[model samples]
Target: MKVVIVGAGIGGLTLALFLHKAKISCEVFEAAPAIRPLGAGLNLLPHATTAFSELELLDRLLERGVETSEVHFYTHHGQFVDGEPRGRFAGYDVPQISIHRADLHEVLLSAARERLGDEAVRLGRVCRSVEQDPERVRVNFADPSGAALPSEEGSVVIACDGIHSVVRKQFHPDDSAPIDHGTTCFRGVTRWKPFLDGATMAYVGTYDTGKLVVYPIRNSIDAEGKQLINWVIEVKKPNDGVRDWNRQVSIEACIEPFVDWRFEWLDIASMLRATDEVLQYPMVDRNPLPFWTRGRVTLLGDAAHPMLPRGSNGAAQAILDARLLAELLATKEPLIALKEYEATRLPATADIVLTNRNRSPDEILRIVEERTGGQPFEQISDVISRGELDEWQSRYKRVAGFERERLPQ
Candidate 1:
């Protein structure tokens, strides 16, 4: 059976690679005329990296990205609350990788082309709509200029087109609206000296005041030995209803909220000033759909479940979807495979979507903030116990399908 995959982003390309490895024929079609190095930093949890390990591309990714060692939580007052080891450092066999979105895409795209041939990925084909019968699926496409392109036929169609998916809209038009979280996030990467062991992922403050997530994506560049540090600032604000991912905004808008965020370990204000550019995006996600499959076409990744970027599970969950769907499609009948993929992944990812909205890993900071009334504490233990902190972390991991014991060996 042949598969037609839409959108050559992380999910689509990874699916292509997995399908090729499974000895299944597939092709990827992307809307953009070319795939360029875009997007900021994202993390691949141990579970996500396990799929890359199976693809034999983990080493290349490791060579380009940082193996995150630990994750730490702090308060708006810059007081340390709790910390834990991650990936191999957390006793998992695979390591959690923190890499630039572009670097990871490069690795996947390069491998796909090498293995599946360059022509396997068709660029500039925007999916207008999809029509399928019992025999086969037909995907209609248009060029970036709105000119019609030849429709492609395949046994099945998988939509990985992201939050603004055309195929998803066609299937579930009533659920097209995004649930705005009433928050704006500012993200950027800056060249700076490492902080807190060089590989630590740090989350500071609560959403009511200001929240900042900081980590290094690329290690050591140039003569001064500065790492590429990625930082995101999330603040509760009225949603402007804009969803552009590359919306550039002044650095002052991002720094005003955290003017006094100068901690003993890292000066958050200075990091914002040093950033060359900052991209702003509305903190938005769609409510979980009742279903993600109908006939031979199914949704994957952001198309299937677009969750808030809270626990760094966006890309990781998509990777999980690709791995599982590819395996099922290779072994089971195409129609049964699509149904099973939805039955398995839809509810699982739906839980993540709701959990991200209500309680995420960062909820630890929120809990501490609420318990202490957002004040500086003389002692962390007096504010929250170690057991409480561990429980919060473990709960999020389990819901997101990355619990140490739950992961497959």
Candidate 2:
């Protein structure tokens, strides 16, 4: 059976690789004229790393990314709240990889091309719509300039086109509006000396005040022995309702809120000042849909569920979707596989979507902030107990489907 996959992002490319491994033919179509090394850093939890491990790409990913050892949490005052082990350090078999999005995309793209052939991915083809019958599924595409392209026919069509997916809109037109959470995120990368073991993912402050997520994506880039540190600052603000990922903004506006976020360990103000470019994104997500499959077409990744970019599950869940759907398509009939994929993933990711709206792993910092009234405490135990911290972490992991015992051995 042949598959026609839309969008050449992480999910689509990974799906192509999985399908190729299963000896099932597939082609990927991307809207962009070319795939450039864009985007900042993101973490691949053990669950995601496990999938890559199966594909034998985990070691190569490790070469380009940092193996996250631990995660540290703090308040806006720089007061230490709690810390926990991650990936293999947390006893999981695979290590959590914190890498630049571009590096990860390049790895998947190169693999897909090498295995599926260079012509496997068609660039500059925007999916205009999809039509299907019992015998086959057809996908219509247009160039970036709105010129029509020859339609491709396959056994089934999978939409991995992401948040503004055209297929998703055609299927669920009325309910495609994004829900804004009144939070604006500013993200950037800086070449600087690492702090806190050089591999720690640090979370400082709460969203109500100022939330900063800091981690190293690449290590030892220059003669100064500096690592490429990725940082994100989230603050409660009015969103202009634009969802462009490449929206560039002045760093001064992002720095003003955290001007005094100077800590003995790492100076947040200096790091922001060092960044050459900063991208702004509004924290938005679509409410979960009732279903993801319609006849011979099914949605994957962001096209299936666009959850708030918390808990780092946006990419991880998408990778999981691609793996499962590819496996099912390889074994089951195309239509049956589409339904089963939705049945298994829709509800699971739905819970995560709703959970990410409020309660995520970072909820620990929010809880401590609430309990301590955002003040610096002499003893962290005096505010919240260790048991409470563990509970919060475990709850989020379960919801995000990355609990150690639940992951594949």
- Candidate 2, after superposition: displacement of residue 14 in Å? 0.8
Q: TM-score per candidate, in order?
A: 0.98, 0.99
The number of residue pairs in model 2 that clash at the backbone is 0
Candidate 1, residues 146-221: lDDT per residue as tens digits?
9999999999999999999998999987885878878888899999988889999999998787899999999987
Residue pairs clashing in model 1 are: none
- Judging by lDDT against the true structure, name the best candidate: 1
Locate the minimum summed-lDDT window of 10 residues in model 1.
Answer: 237-246
The all-Cα superposition gives candidate 2 an RMSD in Å to the true structure of 0.9
lDDT of 2: 0.91
TM-score of 1: 0.98
